[model samples]
Target: MHVVTTPTGQIGRQVVEGLLRAGEPVRVIVRDPSGLSAEVRERVEVVRGSHRELDACMEAFAGADTLFWVVPPTPRADSVVGYYEDSTRAACRAIGARGVKRVVTVSTAGHGIETNAGHLSASLAKDRMIEETGVSFRALQATAFMENLLWQTEAIRHQGAFFWPQPADRVLPVVATRDIAAKATELLLNASWDGRGGVPVVSPDALTPDGMARVVSEVLERPVGYRQLSLDAYREAMIGHGASEAWAQGLVDMAVAQNDGAYDEHHRTAVPSPTGFRQWCEEVLRPAFLA
Candidate 1:
């Protein structure tokens, strides 16, 4: 059986659907089964509890050969790294106890240069904790997700502008979550590959924030502008939106690391995934903005 954690999330939802399409037996660990569609609820075995609970994971991992793991965001936590460790500690123990054969996990692209990267550093640390379990692991090392723009849909729709903490002209790799889910599903289904490694899931286009604005404008047929915010302002904005101080600071640090070329090493060597910036903007962002 294939076990999926965070099955209700953007990426994990797609992973679950992909597996179901292939007629694979699937199990999911979710806090609220109601978050799942009725069709999905009827299709897969649901273990109702947080994946961070050892008993829950042990229950969900039972008779499961492959696992799809994605850490759900905890923006209210006091410490970002501590949240990640707390979330993964139970799964690590459960993996050993269940004797799961393979693990496909969501991880960030900035592997080596994660100093003060906040979320990036935490994700890398999560990867290490999982790897130590010695299961056949594939870390889907993803860059900035284009879907993150969805968070600003209201601002973009009302003001025709988007804001970020990175320079307007700095080129960076961004990916679509669909591509990440596809990669995760593929890895989870195949049983031949062994050993721990990272698969970079980056889109073909490495566009600057300005270039992305242009694409958004062209796709939506409206003039949209990109504005760079200071790190302090960004942190304050996140905090103002109800995130904890540490979580907001973690976002600021992640933006700083991105601006400092954290993902450059992986981008330089990655075989680009299928999604392109324009395609994602046209298909995903355009619909989101109109909605």
Candidate 2:
């Protein structure tokens, strides 16, 4: 059996779909099965429980061949990666006991310092814990998600410009979550995988924030500008959007690193994801922008 955590999410749902299409016996771990869409619930065997419970997690994952694990976002937390670390520890302990041998985890793109990269910290914690389970594992180290553009929608609507913490010209590798899910699904369904794959599934192409706005303008046939905000401006903007000051600053920090080309690891030119940001924008985002 193949089990997926966070299956209702944008990427997880696709993974589940891919697995089902591949004729794999499917199980999904969800907190509230009743809340799941009828189409999705009908597609798989549901393992209803929270991952925070160690024994519950192990039982839910029992007899599974491979696990698609992801820690969903919690923007309200005080500590940067503490929540992710704790949750992953629980999952690792349970998976360790259950003798499940293969795990595919979502990890951040960079291998930088802890506080400098909170997203990186979350994945690093998971990588450390899961690998020790003696499971043959593949940790997908992916770039900034293209869906992050959704965060700037308000600015795009109100100001005719997209505002962000990073400079408009700083190029960062960004991948659609759809692509991440597809690649991850491929890896998980392959039956045999090399040990500890740190696959940096990046965009076949990279773009700057302002360049993205230009594409948006072209695709939507309306002028949209890009504005790079100061750290203070970013903090206030996040606050305006109902985020805590520290959390807001932490985001600002990520953007700052991006501006410095920190998460821009494009060395694996041989390794490429099939879907790029432009295709994703034209297909998925353009309709939302037009609407």
Per residue, candidate 1 scores C-alpha lDDT tens digits across 1-291 of 999998999999999999999999999998899999999999999999999999999999988899999889988999999999999999999999999999999999985555588999999889999999999999999999999999998988888899999999999689999999999999988989999999998888979999999999999999999999999999999999999999999999898889989898888889999889999988998887787
C-alpha lDDT of residue 24 in model 1: 98
> On residues 115-175, what C-alpha lDDT tens digit does candidate 2 reach at each position?
5654565567768888887888988878888888876666677788877677777776788
Worst 10 residues of 1 by lDDT: 108-117
Model 1, C-alpha of 203: deviation from truth (Å) = 0.4
**Model 1 ranges off by over 4 Å:** none
Task: State every prediction's TM-score relative to the real structure.
Answer: 0.98, 0.93
Best of the candidates, TM-score: 1
Candidate 2 ranges with C-alpha deviation above 4 Å: 267-270
The stretch of ten residues in a row with the least summed lDDT in candidate 2 is: 261-270
